[model samples]
Target chain A: MKVRVHVTLKDGVLDPQGKAIHRALETLGFAGVRDARQGKVIDLELACADEAGAREQVDRMCRQLLANTVIEDYTVEFV
Target chain B: MKVRVHVTLKDGVLDPQGKAIHRALETLGFAGVRDARQGKVIDLELACADEAGAREQVDRMCRQLLANTVIEDYTVEFV
Candidate 1:
C-alpha cells in the first residue's frame, strides 16, 4: 500500500521558514500571496496489503517519528 | 483563496534525507516500510478568488522559484 503523510506546524507556533517563503514571494512580485505555511509530505511504500493494517501502521509511524506531536500535526491518507 | 503546492524530488534522483528516514524506521523495528520519500508542501493564502487565475499564478511560482525543476517536480492545487 502507498501512504501519504502531511505534517504541518500547529497554529500559534513561530514559523520562520514559512515567513521566509512569504517574504521571498513578495520580492519576486507575487503580490497575490497573502501568507504561506510550509509543511512536510512523506510518501511511503508499505509491504502490508490490508488497507486497515497499513493505515494503522502509518499512523504509528507518524506519531512515533514523522511528526513532533507537541508542535506539529499530521494526517495520513492511502492512495 | 487557498492554494497548495507539493514539491517532490523526481524519481531516480538521489535522496539522502529519505534514506536516513528509512534507516531510522528500520532501526525502530518498522519492518513493513519498503521505501520512503520526503517532499515539501506549501500552503498559501492568496488574495485572489478565481481558481483558474490562482492556479496559473501558483504554476508560475513553482516554475520560477518554488521548485528546482532540474531535479524536482511540483503540483499545484486550489483549496
Candidate 2:
C-alpha cells in the first residue's frame, strides 16, 4: 500500500519560514502575492494487507512520529 | 482569504529525516510501518478578494518560494 501524509502547522502558530518564502517570492517578481505558508507531505510504502489496516497504521504514524500534535495537524491518504 | 500550501519531497530523493521518523515510529510501537517521507506546509491569511485571484497568487507563491520545484511539489487549498 502507498500512503501520503500531509502535516501542517496549526493556526496561530508563527511561521518564520513561511514569511521568508513570501519575501523571496516578491523578489522573484511575482507581484500580487499576498502571503505564503509551508507544510510537509510524507509518502509511505507499507506492507499492510488492506485499506483499513493502512489507515490505522498511517494514523498511528502521524500521531506518534510524523507530526507534532501540539503544533501540527496531519491527514493520510491511501493508494 | 486563507491559503494553505503543502510541499513534499519528490520520489527518489533520499529523506534522512523521514527515515529517522520511521525509526521513531517503530520505537514507539507503531507496528506495520514500513517507510516515511517528510515535507512542509505553509498557511497564509491573505487580502485577496476572489478565489480566482487567490489561486493565481497562491500558485505563484508555490512556484517562487513555497516549494523547491526540483525536489518538492505543492498544492494550495483556499479557505
Q: What would the TM-score be for candidate 2 when compared with the true structure?
A: 0.73
The TM-score obtained by chain A of candidate 2 when compared with the true chain A: 0.93
Q: List clash counts for every candidate, in order.
A: 0, 10
For model 2, name the residue pairs that clash: A37-B42, A37-B43, A38-B41, A38-B42, A39-B40, A39-B41, A39-B42, A40-B39, A40-B40, A40-B41
Q: Which number leads on DockQ?
A: 1
Report how far residue A15 has shifted in candidate 2, in Å.
1.2
Q: State the lDDT of candidate 1 residue by residue for A1-79, as single tens digits.
A: 8888999999999899899999999999999888899999999999999998888888888889999999999999887
- In the range A3-79, model 2's lDDT, one tens digit per residue, is 88888788789877777877876788766657666677777878787998778777877787778999988888775
| Residue lDDT tens for model 2, B1-79 | 7777777778888889888878887788776777777777676777767999879877876786667899876778775
**What lDDT score belongs to each candidate, Candidate 1 first?**
0.92, 0.77
After best superposition, candidate 1 residue B13: deviation in angstroms? 0.4
List the DockQ of the predictions in order: 0.90, 0.57
Give candidate 1 regions above 4 Å deviation.
none
